[model samples]
Target: MSESKKFSVYLMATLPIVFWGVSFAAAKVALEEADPLLLLFLRFAISLPLLLALAWRGGEAALPTKKQALVLIFMGFMGFYFHLGIQTMAMRTSGSGMANWQMAASPAAAALMSAIFLKERMSRTGLLGALCAFLGVTVVLGLGTKGAKGISIYNFGDFLITVSMLNWAAFMVVTRWLFRDGGYPPLFTIFWEVFFAALMCAPTLALLRVDVGAAARFGAPTWEALLVLGLLCSGLAYAFWYRAAAAIPVPRLMVFQFLQPLVGVVAGYFVIGERFTPWLILGGAMIVSGVYAANSHK
Candidate 1:
């Protein structure tokens, strides 16, 4: 790649990770003003138009065939319903910084799943990496914000994020099975998966009977946070990610996932006052290294 192109590619790859990391802080702020369901709903709702415009500008049809539709629907449920939904709700107590740090294990979890379930060729290094990453999880669980009942409940928030991470990893592995040959553009998957996720999330408004007045009366900071959550975090970040994923080699692109947790930990400390303990360092280092090991062919 030319110098400028290389710079742009790096920028594209880095921005999404940064935005994603910062978003946990933004979500925390937005949650103070809105319920979890309401907050999540707004995110998907706001992003829908932007996604549509992107599709239109790119001259891509937004429609999916029946089989594609089924996969999209499953992705929506897993990505949005179970994954995002649980993560958002967990933030009620979990704090964004810690949650994101726990989420850093996602790629490792995916790699392990692929080895066991999909019969992928995983090196011994990959298996070792998976083991180290899971060990990190226990350390994080012990270090994270504990409940009133202490170890009995542990950090429910962190647990939820872990679940979300696994859910995401599963979606990725399944996507490989469904779209292995690069049959569709990466953008197509992002747009439609989020679209279906939004559809599935829509009914929560009726169940919650969300107060329009409260959402409307949210302070400027909260509104700004929501915009960041919807526009930058959910929408533009995904755009940048897929673009970078396409441009960069798989191994190089995969390394970028490490930045996400790093960003989250920093954001957590400054944004939400999450204490960075020694355990965090040890656990995070293990998870990051483990993910690297699992993803690396060498």
Candidate 2:
């Protein structure tokens, strides 16, 4: 490839990861003004049209069957509704850097879940890596936060983020099952997931008796953060990620994912003034290495 072309390819790969990394801080910013349910509702509601457009561009008229539709609804709820809602709530107490570090372990979680649920074989190295990742998460939970007094006494915010990580892993396994038949186009399935998730969020907000109109009074920072979360992180970043996946080798492209935590740390520091502790660095390094090792077997 020419120098310019190579640059473009690397840029394509890097941008999406940057968007996603910054998303944790963005969510933190939005959470300052709005509750988790409202934040979740705004995110999917804003991104829905963009995802719908991408799905329609595929020109696939075949929709999911009734059985598949039910499955999709469940997937939507698991992946977006509950997963994001819990994570958003977690952000109320967790630092963006800590959230990113915990989430970085999710691939290991997913690999273990796949081995157990799908009967997939895991290499010894993969098993060790999974163990290392969980240990790293424990270290983070024990040492990463400000209020935690000791290993046994953990921050509630960190605990919620850990739950979010496992929930996401389960969602991935379910998504793999849904896509295994190759009946649904990836974009189409994603669109429906966001669509159904947004639909579910509406009733949730109503149940919570949240003042949806209160969002109009939010300051510029909150709106800007929400726009970045909705438009760039959810919409364009996903589209760019899929495009990058098509162009770059999967393994080579995955190297960029490791950069996500670093980006999150930088973003958290600058955007939210989150501190960079030695323990956070040590714990995060363990997570990145473990996830890298866990995924290496594939």
For all the candidates, what are their Cα RMSDs to the real structure? Answer: 4.8, 5.3
For candidate 1, what is the total of clashing residue pairs?
A: 0
Give the TM-score of each candidate.
0.75, 0.74
lDDT, each prediction: 0.70, 0.72
> Candidate 1: worst 10 consecutive residues by lDDT?
144-153
Model 1, range 95-187, lDDT digits (tens) per residue? 654666566666566666665665654567766776676666556545633221223344878778777877877766665555455655667
* lDDT per residue (tens digit) for residues 1-298 in model 2: 6667656766776788789889888898898888888998999988978887877786643477898789779888888888888888988878766777677666656666766875555667756765665666566655654543332335898899899888876776666555555675667777777788899988878988999998989999999999998989878776666545444433334445555666665565676565656777776777667656755543
lDDT, candidate 1, at 11? 79
Q: What's the C-alpha lDDT at position 136 in model 2?
A: 63
| Candidate 1 residue runs with Cα over 4 Å from true position | 1-13, 117-153, 243-255, 268-298
The candidate scoring highest on TM-score is: 1
lDDT of 2: 0.72
Q: Which run of 10 residues does model 2 get worst, by summed lDDT?
A: 145-154
